[model samples]
Target chain A: MSGKLLQVVREDGQVEKALEPRLSDAQLKELYKHMLQVRLVDERGMLLQRQGRLGFYISAEGQEAVHVGAGYALEPEDWYYPHYRDPGVGMMRGVTIQEMFHQLYGNRADATHGKQMPNHYSWKDRNVVSVSSPLSTQIPQAVGTAYAMKYRGQRHVAMASFGDGSTSEGDFHVGLNFAAVWKLPCIFLCNNNQWAISVPLSKQTASESIAIKALAYGMEGVRVDGNDVLAVYRASKEAVDRARRGEGPTLIEAVTYRMSSHSSSDDATRYTPKEELEAWKRKDPILRFERYLRNKGVWDQAWADQLREQTNAQVAQAIQLAESQPKPKLGSIVDDVFAERTPQLEEQLADLQRTHPEVE
Target chain B: MSRELTVVQAVTDALRTEMRGDDSIILLGEDVGLNGGVFRATDGLQKEFGEARVIDTPLAEAGIIGTAIGMSLYGLKAVPEIQFLDFIYPAFDQIVNELAKFRYRSGGQYAPNVTIRAPYGGGIKGGHYHSQSTEAYFAHTAGLKVVVPSNPYDTKGLLIASIRDPDPVMFLEPKRIYRAMKGEVPEEAYTVPIGKAAVAKEGDDVTVVAYGSMLHVALQAAMKAEEQGVSAEVLDLRTLVPLDEDTFLQSVKKTGRLVVVHEAQRTAGFGAELVALAAEKAIEHIEAPMLRVTGLDTPFPYALENQYLPDVPRVLDAIQRTVSY
Candidate 1:
């Protein structure tokens, strides 16, 4: 299984000449910086949760390459339906570290008005639809968006990202089938992180690979090494191009591993083997990308250290800012239920205000 | 000018009218395009508007609904019909979680302009799978408005209104009377306001509340009660979510008695909500204990379908019970 994995950088820092020049030095550095920045934010989030500062956190630890690479490849007009683990994808699409922390803190400045759980973010301006907690539900939504795009004669595509566990959901099959049948300009990206919170891929399906499931829907399927940023970027870019060209959808399964617990609530050590974790640690996406950059002679120890210091400092400031924001108004809880607040909800809100006069 | 049309014809007329008026309005569902929908409610739409606007989708309710929500988010007004309301369970999660919560969850960032139409109710003997009166399931959802039009004239108006509404709506069509009954519908586009109940027949003694196909049953029951010297006021509740509490409450206050009727189960049905409303708000005005004529608390029976659904006699009996109490 490991032999089939694609690689742009070998363990000893050797690169493939053909793909090495595809990313300019500046672009490569930006990709590396984003991956490092998200990883740092994820670490700080976990630390904050441990200190009882934030309610919850879901880390994208070793899976940063998959989101960052694909996020950078997507056009600005493209729509993204992300899962909870893809905060880096949102960050790449212009969601600031401060906004991300604001949501995590469930503050008044958050877009959802402190309604949603941490890590479930949405941005209308960036075309990033909000992520629902249920798995694979967003797949059909992406299909619908792409269908509308094709109907409107637009060249933009919609990409829906999910975990390997989402394959078990019926929406995954239905969405892919509909997309294929209609030739929708959509891409289904399966982040095969092996563990769906304790359920392994072996139990998830009898099939060998999640990518191969696309064959049943009469679509192209590609399996990429999730840890290899260049491979993920190249595969996603091709699929995105094909979709925008009205060539229909493609399924890309990036096989990676979840190097952290499912969320702040879980203890992965109870279910995961220590040996497996140690092996995946050696193949960390950040280290592998740094090795490639070092081999390109565009990176140095001082630059990497400075990048870490800057991202950590930014994360600390964001945490402070999020904590200092005013509490969300109590009336906001009943607002946004509809375009205009119905009299029914207004009555309920009035009742709540009457009961809890101290808060207002 | 008005012409005679059946409920199905009114639905088609409304879709055609809305499609002609708004370019962004689209129709997507199973059998909606070439087949003209399972009940022909969308007949000739694909030919009139082309396949791009009227789409025949795969037989996946969840996908149809989820995609419709997405389309609405992207500025398309969608009317996706579930072939039958009985088979809406598979899409329940999408309707309740995604479509209903889009606006609230997004904090007004997204308001899905979608109208989900489904033919429902019993009387034609389609049995459990084809015949169901389950509007209560959707009416329970907060952000989703539920509409049921009893006649062809109201059907066109309500469908047009739901499509134009910025919020998502669950429009339940009465399958039993889809082609059975006919009424004069106006050619010009008109929207009957949602959250407003119609006074089908005004009387003094009792208020009989009903909607969809059961509105006819309530009328028949009211006529029979009139023959028996009990004048029953019949109320047609067009929308269940934004319920016309004022009309029903005023009628209950005027008549001093209430009888609710529906073709759904007895417990936790929309009828139960009406009874609770009268008890809570208009209790002092009520002279007798309120009663309801509803389907049996069981799966829509295949062999005894008539016995399962609330009928004219049952509604009359509920009125008699309330009048004599």
Candidate 2:
């Protein structure tokens, strides 16, 4: 168990193996840019919350590479069930920055029309299912989708991502057991951010690692360095390939840290010590990826600074567009309850209109 | 063209007919395959449809619902049953949060054609765990349809309709009348439209609204009311959500009196919703204030089961109070 966890990049910017020669320069740059873009998004969201411009925000922060890497590993046809903190994955799966801001601002342009809180993003075109707030509920649903895929004889697999705290949920157990029993084409990617709200991972489970628990369900479990982008991508690619080939599900536990409070409403300083937070800050995923690119002679300080400025500008413009949009109309509140509105709902909508007088 | 069948037999007959008519329809639950279900509701389905269509799932209710949600999303009519309604609590989160909201949350992109069948209500002496009137819970949840059938004929038609419906449905079969009640059910498949009420008996003095096993008790009370020269209108509200407010409203408007009955607890029961609807829609027309005959606000008791359930006397008392008022 001690030696099984996989790591490709060390903290000192040393690679155990040469991946650059095989990975095209464009793909490498794209992966690096995605990680940086997600980081920029997270940081700006926190600032927006501080300024009272946004109602709520939950940043992926130090865990951007894991999400970006896993997102890059799947095909567009595959179904993805993401946790609430996977805005990075949402962006990769065809959710434009403008659309994400629409969700963040909960404007009329938002697909849910502010029905869900901010960070709840879903795109049906890319097969990204809407995410629920309940812990680990996506696990079994993902397995079910995978089972359906198998039943229909489709070659595509289904992937679900979650936090370490989600592993303790009953849905997680049910999902793993059902997937294994039926040999469904599914992947369970657990981003072990080490903290669920205020509770640490140690208190969450007595088991040494979340990955090892997969063995009890008769499935393969792999622990990867979540901070290392290449390692996460490689592991996810292999699991996705295996699933497409009808090899059933694999549970991949990405070992990383959460460098921010749980959400805008939380204060991590109360529970997480300053020293621990400071120590993890040095292992920041963005910093490590920048170093890795520099060592490979593919990046420099000038290019890095220019890229950050361009990405920040792009994010700022999206926020501006999102903020300028008008609020949702009151009539839409009664809409989408079902495919077709019941007469009772139509009457309720009429009542709201009658009372408001100004809304259409 | 029709044969007399009990409620439990009608359930199996509907499953067999539907599975034959539609290849996408399947059944999954604990012991539903080889054991023919606890109440033999799915008897011989595994043999007729094979194990793939009639799956025997693990004893995880959440998994059953979760997998069914997936199957439905994948374009199959997935009907999973809980052996008893009481065991469905573990899967409540999946049903309400995931299955119920799939169509709405996805902004109508996907509708989970999943039907969860459970046997509920108390007259069988199964104690607290086996007997519970939990329809109100599902009925209260938005984007979900709730149906309960008292007689075998309605049970078959409603179950068939639920299987074909493009949304998630909670089909609660009254366990008490599973065998006690029998009616002529059609041999061929047919659908009873959801969200519509059936007039069990037409009268003009008082409107008595009930469903599932309580409908039988309501009928008895109405017959006794007839002996005293009082005409009672008995309405069977098969579908609680998308409720047929028109049928009951018209009846209450004609009679100028209303009495709602159910075996669920008093507070926030389906009965409360009916009474509230009456007061909201036809308050001015009603001659007497509406009354509800419901089970006490207590967990179903083991020893005093008869006392716990709302009986004919309770319904009669409610009728007398409404008629005399």
Candidate 3:
């Protein structure tokens, strides 16, 4: 729009693209397949909610490339603090479609043990921390983890992702500022989807760009086309590498869009215009990446058809498994409050059991 | 084996002892290292444990708490000091949303194992920001455990317990007794069980319940009432959430009168919640009335803090009112 916006390759759907660092034909296929899987998962999730299967859900549509691209750019040991709408990232990090669906359906088989609502998943041993519904709170926590990594003299990095709306919170700035000053290995990935719930970017912030905000904190800031998986991968790779090397934190704002209702409970048509939706629809992350991969000779109709069929069947099997699992135990209300339940909690638990005698 | 020490000094001793025993236990806060913290609760921890364990963080509340979470996730026992309880607002989101929900959201996959330490309650000349008792904020969160110690012994024991706890604990140290209340603590490693209320002076006529700095005032009021031949059971609620309702209900049933006291504002203070809870549980108990002795339903006044606090006179006054009503 102004002063030659950064681009990896000119977009015409037929233009040849250059090879990226560390991304071979196989890896690109891996990234694209995951992106496509995320898109279909998002579609099925929405349909499932409409059919009264899920209570509510956050969509990961239209931003698959940003999540997968960025996720693929990191090491397994690096800490990942994901926000609510992070199924794409989770899918890329070896979380099964079954585990994700099981968690969404509140099945006891859910990895979270049915503790959180849909889209909030975490593996304590996976180095990827569980995310809550609150926005921007993890920024400082991630920074703190990075500080500890530096303190422990480990070559690990700590990274957190949040929306553009999160940058307005005080903790977001405090975390980044502390990381920059202390030279902690923290990576802040800002998914600038242009909206936080109903508030648009115009009302949520007055800054020129979220990336620019990092400049004031003495951190490297990169703005990338979120639909371009190559660019997102490269930018995140360099930033994460610098963080792993202890050069301090870096902020990368992935310019993207929310292609669906904010959640199952939201109706975005009230605030978003048709033209705006169409404009963002044209930049669908999966299609753009598919175009790039096709020009690279790694994509064909046969592969596309196979991936679609396999993914649909896998998702269906996951849904059936998720639906078949039993609900969590209601008696667990008093468990884990302490190493052992206190007398007071025990009394309450007894009262609850008496009131609902059918449980336990 | 026993010696007299201020509440602040006992806390410092407990931290030093705990840190020396475990290498994973770390302390981080502004001025906690070089300046020895605002009240010196962590006076010599930095020098004793080295900078790696006793970290001096930047002047950022969010930074302090959020970073402690990271340390906790990394299998380190983290204790974050909020120089003053009133200064904890900036970090409320992190504590309530992240630290509190770590275990619940992760389905018990990850426990925060963090303790947020802050000095609360009135008596010194700290106007609004430093003197207010803000324990209710932490109590409302579903997964967090809140603890407030009334004296030097409880401070040391509860702090040691909080450090070993598997969940996030918002540990409130009474500012009023930081230097005033003196007591003898065990010279060995021990921890007071949280969620258990201590019966300071057991009786059957009336139940006067309070915690943190207000325990001293409540005890003093109970003594005066004892001289009047109306025995008052002073129950110090060491922990707020998962409240010791067993002790509270038992005391209320035996006494037939309930009077809750605290330095927090009256409208929806922890005292009010306790009164309602007790009423709902043991409503058949024939008490004179359920009364609450608390600060006025206003922010801690800058100049009139003394009049605003629920002191011995005010607590005694409330006890009289509950009995007469």
Candidate 4:
């Protein structure tokens, strides 16, 4: 593990010329647009939750670069096991705003069919595993998938994302140890947002850094400035390339902050210091990426304004479409419990349908 | 051809046969590779299939099951052994919440084709942590098929069926009878349909319902009851989740008396579900109150294991009581 944090763009958006990735102007603009879309959608989701139109909301307000940059570095063949705060990753991988909205509303059109809570998106066709609530559980699952890939002689890699708090879980240790021992093609990304429902990173770990913890597992560890999109993409691309070359797993710790409250139910004001929040807001991922794009002559005020309007309009249309959809049908309640419904479940469903004829 | 084999040997035969047929089948556990498992249920499998398909994983139950779920999601048949049913708690959340709910929670997008095999029940004098019948935990959770085989024939057939099932199945082997009981088993690959029960013995006075090692005790008790001039019918419930209610209900209807037996705790054991099923569906045909013969409501003890588990004498007593009632 290199003790230094990898940074391609400084806080003022000035690039470290030697480390800056050689991305085309169009790709640069695309990255900024992807991050901006996440911000706009998250804002609308929060407002909807506050207005009682949605049940709950969790925003990745300050960690856009971490998810989007890393997601952009992967190929479509790679499998992603995402945490809840990964809407930006899904967007980079072809998840439409309408699809996300449908999930948030838990409408019949939702891919998960109202089974999981809002923001828990899953696109099986895109090779994205469903988001589970339990912490660090996906770590071992990702390793297992990577193991299968290696056994089948497939070149594809498996990547799993989680927060700093998840690093403390037993699954985290078990997963890393197994991957290291087997030299599986996997990537462990820690989105160090620094807060897990009001618990700070200090309370979560006493180590020098989350990346350095990988040394114990005998895997390569890289720490990057997660607020810098260029830095995150570079680190993720290198790790993805290494994994594809059969060099085994890599642990990438993208350090950033969570600018929003934990969820719709949380009040960040109760624990977060006012000054600390202000400091992180100035170094916001979107603002930093906008400066970087402007420095490259790819971003202008008019384009930024137009993009915001277009994105917000898209979000509005998606929200309308999702809200107009009906809730999942009553019979669907027992539909996917197994490949085929058991006789007992069939009897229970019959009883329910018989009693609630009006609902059907 | 048919040959005499123990329950444990039948398990090995089933895994070896399945692995030979399907290259995608992966066998993984703590001591599965090179060690052939602590109980030798996977004996000679790693040598035949090689280490890539037969893996020895780290000593973490959650890791074993979680990884197996991942493998299944990626279109592989993953059979993970928990070593013992007592040590499955660490992976309980993964099994109950993740593996069981993957198909439903994904809205049918992803269904984990995983079959978790574990050795359960008492009588090995393993005591406490090594001996427990925790099938009720998995049986209570939907999306999982809980299967327990009492004999060699059922062990091989049911295991093959569980591996081929589209959904996750919990295959709990009774360690007590893993080697103690032997029966003729077909060497060819065959599947005994899941969600079905077998009538081990048929009689008229009372119906005795049991599974796993307890089924052996129930059969013995039925024999003793027959000698005592009391007719006892034994029903071996192979699968508890998708329980064969029709078979048991028919037996209760004919006998007019129900006695459920299990080696799990007395409170809320699978026997309770059987009793409730009889009461709800066959209440009119039942002549007396349904009785449950199960382990006492306490942690499995080290010194008093014989007293802790349901035995032939205890089952015979329950049958006599239910018959006379």
Instruction: Please provide TM-scores, in order, for all candidate models, with all chains considered together.
Output: 0.98, 0.96, 0.94, 0.99
Two-chain complex of model 1, DockQ on C-alpha atoms against the true structure: 0.80
lDDT of 2 by residue, B191-262 (tens): 999889999999999999999999999999999999999899999999998888899899999999999989
Error of 2 at B316 (Å): 2.2
How much does candidate 1 score in TM-score?
0.98
Q: For all candidates in order, state the fraction of native interface contacts they contain.
A: 0.67, 0.57, 0.71, 0.78
Kindly report which residue stretches of model 2 are placed more than 4 angstroms away from their true locations once superposed. A1-3, A18-22, A300-306
Question: By DockQ, is 3 or 4 better?
Answer: 4
Using DockQ as the measure, name the better of candidate 1 and candidate 2: 1
Model 2 steric clash total: 0
Error of 3 at B26 (Å): 2.3
The true-versus-predicted C-alpha distance at residue A69 of model 3, in Å, is: 1.0
Residues A240-260 of candidate 3: C-alpha lDDT, one tens digit per residue? 888877687889888889888
Candidate 1 chain B, run of 10 with poorest lDDT:
B102-111
**Model 1 interface CAPRI class:** medium
Tens-digit per-residue lDDT, B13-122, candidate 4:
99998888899999999999999999999999999999999899988999999899888889899999999999999999889989998999889999999999999989
Q: Model 3 compared with the native: what TM-score?
A: 0.94
On lDDT, the leading prediction is: 4
**Highest DockQ: which candidate?**
4
In candidate 1 the C-alpha lDDT for residue A200 amounts to 91
Worst 10 residues of 2 chain A by lDDT: A17-26
